[model samples]
Target: MLSGQSFMMFVVLLCTCAFAFLNGFRDASNSIAVAVRNRALTPTYAVLVAAFFTFVGTMASTSFGVYLVSAVELGVPDGIPGLALLLSGLLAGGAWGLFCWWRGLPISSTHALIAALAGASGASALLGNDGVHDAWRMLAGGVLLPLLFTPLFAFAASWVLVIPVTWLVRHSTASDVNGVSRAGQAVAACAVALGNGLQDGQRTGAMLTLALVTAGAAQPGAIMLGPQLLGAGCLAAGVLFGGWRIAHTLAYRLVNIDPLRGMVAQTVSAAMLFFGAMLIHLPISTTQAVTSSIVGAGTNQRFESVTWQQVNKVLRNWLATPLVCALLGGILYLAMHPLVS
Candidate 1:
């Protein structure tokens, strides 16, 4: 007969899957917020579109993105031996994401996943080296990029983008400019959704796969297509549902963004995320990217127009994101450790 201890470990893995579902529910705010708020699409339709892309992206990539994020970095081994770490990670990430959502503070699922992975792996390293180097690499890819470049680059990139469109209006014929701008807005918004799907969806896939590994159902080296599908499906559905409150904040409150400015910021942020997902295999936060992009574009409009208070609020939450996740994960593990063991 299977050992009782083994069965408990399986329960831990199930919890990890539960966390993946929460990630979908909590982070759904990121993709559809802009589309729904802009009146480009109804909230329901926006979420549907977002959900479809998230599902496609998460399901398509097997071993990449979320799986690697959830599994390899936290020192979780390929097989069933890694349950504690995996469950700890999912718990950490879910708590962090939920906290942010409750506060109506937009933090990146990318950031949450990275921090949770670190906490799990860091704690696990106390036992022995399973696979923490990947965590360090992830630190570079996920956190470092957002911290170093997102605000600066996103800000600058948005301005650079806006300059051309503004200039085109000035230099080109004015007769059809409004129609052209409107058309451009539609295209840009859809592109942002696509880009976010390519980037963020992969993280969902990674997390789902990690859940399977926690249960000993798969190896880190092996790909679980089922988990990927579930992750993608949840993420996309969440996006389709959309977070109306946060969307309102991002669309109107963060900065005084008109349609053209919003388009540039969204597109630039999406591009950064897409490139990171494809090339760096790094998970970047669309929340940070878009916010920074908006700040960037806003700064160009007038230094005074950019809302420093809003940015600070976001920064404070950014600082809080990892701390909360780590603390919660450790506590949850301690409380459940004996039961799991």
Candidate 2:
């Protein structure tokens, strides 16, 4: 017979896996959409490459996981209540991700996860004398700031990079330009995939680690390789199985993706993500970065070709994701509090 703590730990691991899968499923397009859209790689080949790189990138670093666990202080009670809180947050985040995937909306899973955790923490705090001040502070500094700024930075950076590059290569023959762009797209896609793996992979790993600590299976400072591998593998599987609908939305609906534009946007997005992960130590959204870069590139080359309607819809989804997931997480925590308490 399993101990009660063991059972709760099992549930937490399952929820973590599910959350990782949904994260990969919904965000896979961020790494591959440009390459597929530009015909630099077939859809099947792009997915495989993206999966492989995602795995490699995830295994390469655990810094983001460390930051998430240390920085975000959720004031939930430890043990069973903590497990319940984690499960609730994961469920809320995963639900929002699946909903967005179904609707072909490329919203930020990062934001959903952060907001869900915030909501659950807030709810837990409410049950005691403490308010959600720490949760709010962490949410604003660790999550919201990055979410707000990175996309705008990517947008401006992509526009600046594309305009000059386009002008410099304006005199090149069409075939030459196409060939160079295809090569660039391939390389940039791989970079984006790697970045996604590192940032998102660490996030899921951190969640699993937190759960393990709560269950007494691991210490707070310890990050087990098994859970990290499991998270990475599940993420790759999600990339392989899901992502077409959101890919289409990102690749075709928001802006026309030519080989040159695709390469530039992908490269810029990957660079921004890498900078954030390494230097800033922030877990920025690859989805937002990639999509905004694509839009920026399009706007620079041919402003009229960009579809503002689709862009607006995506923006709305981005804005709504955190709020919706927060509410869902709060409701779930409230419902589970009685049982867990």
Candidate 3:
């Protein structure tokens, strides 16, 4: 017979996997949105390439994974309460992700999950758990600040990047520029997909690692390959499932992006992701970076072609994601307190 603790751990892992899948499903478009819009690659091929590169990125490094575990582990309670908290946060984050996807809005899963965890931590404090004190502080420094600025940085970088790219090709014919940019966009798409895997892959792996430590199956700071592979596989599968609604919103609704602009946006976004993962050890949203870059690049060409209403809608969702998921997580944790406590 399975022990109660083991059962709880199993439940947490199951929720984690489901959340990972939903994450991939929602974020799948981040890498390929601009590429597809510009016809750099077919929808089918774009997804396949994105999935492959994402998996590779997920397994590439653990620096960000280690940082995530440390940051979040500080806030979670010990033992069963911790497992319950994690479960609640995952459920809340995953639910919010689906809601946004259904609405065809791309919000940051990274922000949602961290905010959910912080909310669950607050609930734990209400239940007299002492580990919740630094939750918000850690979240602010680690996730919020980075997320807040990433989009702006991506926007500026992508917008600036186009100037140099265009200058180099100034002498080239329109056909030449389009042809080169199409191939460049394809490569850049894979790069962004890889960066997505690196950042998002760490979130799932860190969550699983935290659960294992809570369940006494592993030690803190010791990330295992099994969990990494599992997280990568689930994420890659989510990418394969594809989030066409969100993709369409990005590719078709947000802005009109040519091959040149698309390539620059994707490349800049991918560079930002890599920087966040490797050097800064922050979990920035691929969606925010990619979306902002696309818009920024598009604005440089024809400001009228960019859709402000759709941009406002996405921005509203971005602002709302953290608050809504936090409240939802707190509610779920309070509801689960009776059973777990």
Tell me the number of clashing residue pairs for each predicted model: 11, 0, 0
Task: Compute the lDDT of residue 337 as modeled in candidate 2.
Answer: 78
Q: Lowest-scoring 10 consecutive residues by lDDT in candidate 3?
A: 63-72
Instruction: Tell me each candidate's TM-score.
Output: 0.85, 0.95, 0.96
lDDT of candidate 2 over 1-341, digit per residue (tens) = 99776898899899888888888887889988878878888888988999999888877757453345331354444578778877888899899888889889998787788788788887877787232337777678656787789879989998889878889899999889989999989999999999998888887777777788777777666467987788889888888875788998988899876788888999999998788788778878889999999998888864477989989998898888878988998899899878877
The candidate that achieves the highest lDDT relative to the unseen native structure: 3
- lDDT scores in order: 0.63, 0.82, 0.86
On TM-score, the stronger of 1 and 3 is 3
Tell me how far the alpha carbon of residue 327 in candidate 3 is from the true structure, in angstroms, after superposition: 0.7
Task: Indicate whether candidate 2 or candidate 3 has the larger lDDT.
Answer: 3
All candidates: CA RMSD (Å): 3.3, 1.9, 1.5
lDDT of model 1, residue 219: 73
Which of 2 and 3 is the better model by TM-score? 3
> Model 2 segments beyond 4 Å from truth?
63-66, 69-76, 129-133
